[model samples]
Target: MTGSDPKADLHRYLQVARAAMLWKLDGLSEYDSRRPLTPTGTNLLGLVKHLASVELGYFGETFGRPSDEPLPWFEDDAEPDADLWATAAESREQIIDLYHRAWAHSDATVEALALDAPGRVPHWPAPRNEVTLHQILVHMIAETHRHAGHADIVRELIDGAAGLRKDNDNMAPGDQERWRNHRDRLERVAQEAGRSAAVLPS
Candidate 1:
């Protein structure tokens, strides 16, 4: 394991995050996948759409290998946060397909470039915008996992499903009744702590 190639390691982690992102949509209905679960309209499919755009921008445009795909939502006159969601016209399958294509394109960029290969982020501030393939890979891994975390919560809210991945849930061992009891205990603890603080010296 210690002899593993650095680039391969980074790419593997990026792929893991990508898989987790898509796995979140498994068995979800179109409505459940698209429905806004958060105050800011975060949804499972929206997360997929947003990450696809992120990968394209970071890996494609930054590397001077731009994608031919038309992304009107990113145009100057487009609505705010247009990339953060899909329209009714954009079917779930379509968005997921786009995401898969984006992954292929990004992977090509990764394969063609060395870790230190230079690229520039046109949208980032000057000087700071200059970056290497290594930097982009690290940045993207964090970005994808961050959104995957959001999907985890959103998916759980829509149904009772929750986990790090389909293979390993990474949750405490418990039945629903046990889980409910655990939550109740935490609530009681919180309430007790709140009262204790309220009675503390001013």
Candidate 2:
């Protein structure tokens, strides 16, 4: 494919990641949206909260432009991993709104600074704390997409629905029965391999 503008490209990918993440909550009840589907308590709303914090830090504070919002999760006495999930009192709308606001703030930072503009990550280790806007952009894009992947799995577990995104699922076309047969074949192969390995020398 032909190449386009760099900043536009980065922002486009970032938006895709963001939309994928938010789409995971579609058609889910409030309870399901916040449900922790993983052993480590990786929930949909929490993922949004975590990414919002990440965007605030990497794009805002790292560039010496702090957000006007207060993140109590980052406070000194806040419990560890507070940003990773929302509390019972927190509503889905509130967290989602905050995440959207973070996007706006982050976009402003990207617009104001050149990609090569100098920045500092105070939370990072001393030796590697210094960074450029381009580096931060790359880092945030990776970070956002990683969580989007997590959301994909978690969303599947909550319901049977799974895909890359709403408009473009990017999944192999197959009916439910076909998919089940495919999975069963893979499981049988795995079991056979396991049995074979079990009898081999330690």
Candidate 3:
């Protein structure tokens, strides 16, 4: 396939990562979407909330295009990790809509600046606070995809549903029995290794 323009290419990949992350929340009850699947309280909707705030800061305020939206979670007196989880009143619809709006605002910042356009990250430490549009684009891409990976695992834990996306599962074709057998084999190998390590000389 032919290549897209640089900005278009970056934006396309960012959208892919965003969609992949949001797709993990599809077809789940509100409780399931907000349920903390991991010990650290990582949940599908929480991830959406986190990314929305991340984009708003990196693309909006960092670049001098502050969003009209207020993020109480980032306020001075807010609790630690406030943006990392959704509150009871924060519905899945609200978080998702915020994320989509972040996309639009972030897109505007991208459109208004060149790749080499300079900006300062006020939250960052000295000597590394300044950045360009290209840097932020790459940074957000990595951040978005990292969360998408988390969402992939969380989604699987929720209902055993696993895939890169709806149309393309991106997993090897295997029956449930075959997959179970494979997992059992891996578990046995891991246990053996653990046992062997335990018996090693100090």
Best by TM-score: 1
User: How do the candidates rank by lDDT, highest first?
Assistant: 1, 3, 2
Which of the two, 1 or 2, has more TM-score? 1
TM-score of each: 0.98, 0.96, 0.95
lDDT of 3 at 202: 97
Once fitted onto the true fold, the runs of candidate 2 whose alpha carbons sit more than 4 angstroms away are 1-3
Against the true structure, candidate 3 reaches a TM-score of 0.95
Each model's lDDT: 0.93, 0.92, 0.93
TM-score for candidate 1, please give it.
Answer: 0.98
Summing lDDT over every window of 10 consecutive residues in candidate 3, give the lowest-scoring window: 2-11
- Per-residue lDDT of 10 in model 2: 89
Worst 10 residues of 2 by lDDT: 3-12
lDDT of 2 by residue, 94-176 (tens): 99999999999999999999989999998899878999988888998999999999999999888879999999999999988
Question: Who is ahead in lDDT, 1 or 3?
Answer: 1
Please list all clashing residue pairs in model 1, or write none if there are none. none
lDDT of 1 by residue, 1-202 (tens): 3587999999999998999999999999899999999899999998999999989999999989999878888999999999998899899999999999999999999999999999999999999999999999999999999999999999989988999988998998989999899989999999999999999999
